[model samples]
Target: MIDETDESLNKSSLVFGNFAVLVVFVLLVGGVYLWVSKKNKTGQQVFPAGVNYLSPKGDEAKKPVLLYDFAKLAESSDWVTYKGKIYPFSFQYPKVLTPLTFPNDRSDAVTFKVNELSPEQSLLFTVETISSRDKNLVGKPEEFAKNYWKFFSGLKALNKITKITNEKGMTGYQATYVVKGKNAITSDNYFFVVEGDDEILLHIGDIFPTEGKAVLNRLVNSLEYKK
Candidate 1:
């Protein structure tokens, strides 16, 4: 009877050990499956599946280039003289000029007038060549800046200056200002005051409309100085 009892006890212990081993194997496999599933869901690793890496061929990636010709325009204008360097003023829309008159103080200075289509545009382009003596009398750039502020107190009041950049490409001191008031709008006015040179070129204008930007870009792109 004692021998039978011992054999039964040994069989029961072996069965429990085998059952525990099977449970541990199952738990390990389940843990690995969960880890892999979580990794895939979180996109931590790329799947071994194939991917299409090439960009589509139909789309042209190049930007359209703009071109302009100022010489051709200068030839057509009677008001413009070929003896001096020519500045181009070409636009998509027809521009009508208003009568221009010289200021009482600056009799030699010439001013050309035009009507701005909207409040957001400039209505005139003033170009003047100052003599060396006049430039010296007025003082250099620093003095001119001080005098400019004194004369145009509105400029100081509004303080719409966005940037004052040294535009070496255009060869001058470029001070950009945002216009104010009901008709006042944001526009670009380029002032080119060449150092030691008395001649100052002022290009005051508004940006072309979205539809006209392409043509305007071409016009500006064509700009060149006759040296």
Candidate 2:
């Protein structure tokens, strides 16, 4: 028969063990939270199972190649300037594309879509405020873009996300992809820059046919943002 003192000691030991386990669990959870928070602040993308990411290229020649006569396009195509009503940003686009409506508040999304919707003819351009600071977005814009690709609903990337910058000094992100049941490939480019407490998203989407893509790339190269 065990003594009453032994029973009390055993009970105390069991309780102490349970308490220690709880403390360890809490510490582990907190460490994970801090790690994720740091990753988000630095901009990291989470990849899904079975999804592949291509290694970045060392030279411009090794990246996904898109050939077009930029000099000819720049020399011949008429261009127009577009200023946002909500965000203090502006950019230029060729006259071949039409500008659509956007909001006039703290954030907006301006789109330029081709009038025709052919598989190869379909093209789109968009500029908007990210509103992440306002909406309390958990991660950086790159992370958001990666999440977009991971669960893109209908599209998957054809190449790795690339880093790009415009002549106006605005840095941007670019990703190219091909959707199922579509004859044309698409490129989604996202430009983000911070102002005050908000970040801007200049998303450019283009479908195949090298001419239109070239025109859009020209427009991207001309993007600008106000201080």
Best by lDDT: 2
Clashes (N, CA, C under 3 Å) per candidate: 0, 0
Off by over 4 Å in 1: 1-124, 129-169, 178-185, 207-222
Model 1, residue 154: C-alpha shift (Å): 5.9
lDDT of 1 by residue, 102-199 (tens): 34523122222222232212232334333332565242543332223223212322223332333123333323232222222223333344444445
* RMSD over all Cα atoms, model 2: 13.4
lDDT by residue for model 2 (119-170), tens: 2223244444445423444336665555445344345555457777778787
Q: In model 2, which regions exceed 4 Å deviation? A: 1-73, 102-107, 113-115, 118-123, 127-139, 156-158, 178-185, 195-199
| Predicted structure 2: lDDT | 0.54
Query: What TM-score goes with each of the models?
Result: 0.32, 0.52
